[model samples]
Target: MEKLLKAERISYHADGKKVLENCHIELRRGEIVLLLGPNGSGKTTFFKCIAGILKHSGNVFVDGVNASKMKAHERFRLGVVYSPEKMRVAENLSVKENLAITGDVNEAVEFFPELKKLLKLKAGNLSGGERQLVVLARSLISKPKYLLLDEPFAGLSEKAFERVLKILVEKSEEMGIAIITHERVESVLPYVTRVYSILSGKIVSVIEENFEKELKRYLLID
Candidate 1:
C-alpha cells in the first residue's frame, strides 16, 4: 500500500493553551485506521488539522503535498475529505435533493438503501441515524482518496450502527480512511488495520498487529 498521508511532530494550541503536542501518524491507501480516545482527547482538533481547518506547527503531507501550506479547497482537491461529528446538511432540503447537490445519490443509496424511501423527506424530519447516512452519502460523492469521519456512528441504534459500519467498510476498502470514535470499537474491528490511542492531546500508543484484540481490551469490549 502506498502512503496517502503523514503527520510529523504535529502540535496545536488555542488561546495560548496546548491542545496537541508532538503527534505523528501515517496513513496508507486502501486502509482503514481508527483513532480511539475519550472526550476532550483532541481527536476532533487533530482531525481539523488534517483537514486544514486549523493551523498547527508541524508537517502534514497529503499524497506528498504539504497540507499546512495548502488551502482547505486545495486539500479537498487532493482527495482529503473531512466529515465532522455534527451533521451540516440543509435541514429544509429533501434527502434526494441533498444527495443530488453532491451528485452521488446512486452510489450512496447502494450503501444505504433505506434512504430511497426517505428521498423526498426533509433532512430535519429524519432520525439522527438517517441524517448521518445522508451526510455520509454527500461526503462520498467526491470520491475522495482520504476520508475522515468523527464519531459517525454516534446517536445511531445498534442496527443502524451496524449498517453504517458496513458502508464504511466498503468505502474504506476503496480508499484510505481515518475514523474517530470511543464507542463500538468491536463493530469496526474487522475493517481496521491500525489503531491509535490518544490521551491528553497526544498519541500514547500505536498498534499495528492484532489491532482488533488490542482495541477490544482498550475499549473494554464486553
Candidate 2:
C-alpha cells in the first residue's frame, strides 16, 4: 500500500537546542503503528512536526504532495489529524456540544456507545475516561485519513483501555494510525502491526514481529 503520510530527515531545534535529528517515518492505511520511547524521547515533538504545528527542518509528504510548509489546518484538510497528549475541551460545554463542534457524532457514538448516555452532561463533569471517549469520538468524527494520537490511553481503567483499543483496531481497517503511549505495554502489544522505538530523538529500532521479545531487546520493556 502507498504511504498516506511520509516524513524524512525530520529535525527540530528548540531555544537553540537540538531536540530531534534526522528522523524518518511513514504511515499506511490498514495498519496500526506503535511509537515507543521514554519521557523526553521527542515522541510528542515528532508528532507535532508531522502535524505542522511546530516549525522544523524536514520533508513531509501527504498523498505524494509536499506538506513541509503547510499549516495545521491545511494538514487537516489533507486528512492528517494530530491529537495532542493534553486532552482539551470547552469545560463549560456539554459533551454533545464539544463533539458537535467537529461534525456529526453519530458515527462517533457508534465507535463509542458509552457516550450516548453522557451526551447531556458538561464535559468537565465527566470522568477522565469519559472525557477521553469524548475526545476520541470528536477526532473520529472528522474522518481523518492519518491519525496521530499522543497518549490516547491516559487516565483510563483497564476496561476503558480495552474499549478504546478495540475502537482503534476497527478504525485501522480504513485509516492509517500512529499511537504514542507509555503505559500498558502488554495490552497494546497484540494490537499493533509494527513498532518503532525512538530514543534521544532518533528512531533506534523497528519491530515487525516477535514484539514482546523485540520490545524487551530494545529496552522498551523491562
Candidate 3:
C-alpha cells in the first residue's frame, strides 16, 4: 500500500482562469481509483498535469521522484502511462504496424487477440471500437506502474465495455490505475477501491469502500 504518486496543493491556470486550485491526491500501488466528475470539472486537466503533459504548481511525485523535475521520457521509464480520450494512431499504418511503431506489438497482441487477426488491416479502416482496443492494448504494453485513463469506456457497446473493463481490472491488480469517467459509476463500482468526485476544479469528496452505503446515499442511487 505504499504511495506510488502524491500531489500536494496542486494548481493550474489557463487563459488567466484557474482550472485547479490547491488540489491533492495520493495513489497507492495495486489500487484502482476512479475519478468522477461532470464536464469541465478538471479531471482531464489533473491527469494531464500528472502525466507531465501540462505544467502546474504543485508537488507531483511518482515513486518518490518529482514528476516536474523529470523529463517526459524519464517519467515514462518510471511506468506512468496516460491514454487520452482521443485516438493518436497513424492512419496510414496497419494495426500491427502501429503497435510495432509504439514498440509494443508483441505484448499488445497477447492481451487482445482480436487485434492480432486484424494485424494487416489499416488503422483508419478499423471501427471506432477496434481502434480503441488497439489503444488500450498499446497502453498495457507499456507495463505502466500507474495508468491514467480518460474516458476509456467511451464509444463502446456494452459487451465491448465489459471486455475492456476486464482487461483494466486485470492490469490494475498488477499496478495502480486511475480512471476518469462521467458515465454511470455503477458499471465500475464493484471493481473500484476508492472514488474521488471533482467539481469546479476541486476534489469535492473522497469515498472509500467502507462508505459504500453513504456514498450511494450521496449519489442518490437507490
- RMSD values for the candidates in order, in angstroms, are 2.2, 1.5, 2.2
Q: How do the residues 1-222 of candidate 2 rate in per-residue lDDT, one tens digit apiece?
A: 466789999999999999999988889889889889989999999999999999999899998989999998999999999877867777899989999987797777887888999889899898877888788888888889999999999888888888889888988999999999988878888878889889999998888999999888877888
lDDT of 1 at 170: 79
Q: At residue 113, what lDDT does model 2 achieve?
A: 88
Residue runs of model 1 more than 4 Å from their true location after superposition: 1-3, 212-222
Q: Per-residue CA lDDT of candidate 1, range 58-150, in tens?
A: 988987777877777788888888888877778999999998986678887887788899998999898877888888878888688898888
Score each candidate by Cα lDDT. Answer: 0.83, 0.88, 0.80
Q: Report the C-alpha lDDT of model 3 over 58-173, residue by residue, as the tens digit.
A: 88888877786665567778878888887666779999888885567878877777887899999999888888888787788877889898888877778888888888888777
Each candidate structure's TM-score, on Cα atoms with residue i matched to residue i, is 0.90, 0.94, 0.90
Clashing pairs in 3: none
- Candidate 1, 194: how far from true, in Å? 0.8
Which residue runs of candidate 3 sit more than 4 Å off their true CA positions? 1-3, 210-222
For model 2, the superposed segments whose C-alpha errors exceed 4 Å read: 1-3
| Residue-level lDDT for 135 in candidate 1 | 83
Q: Please name the candidate that would achieve the greatest lDDT relative to the true structure.
A: 2
Q: Which numbered prediction scores highest in TM-score against the true structure?
A: 2
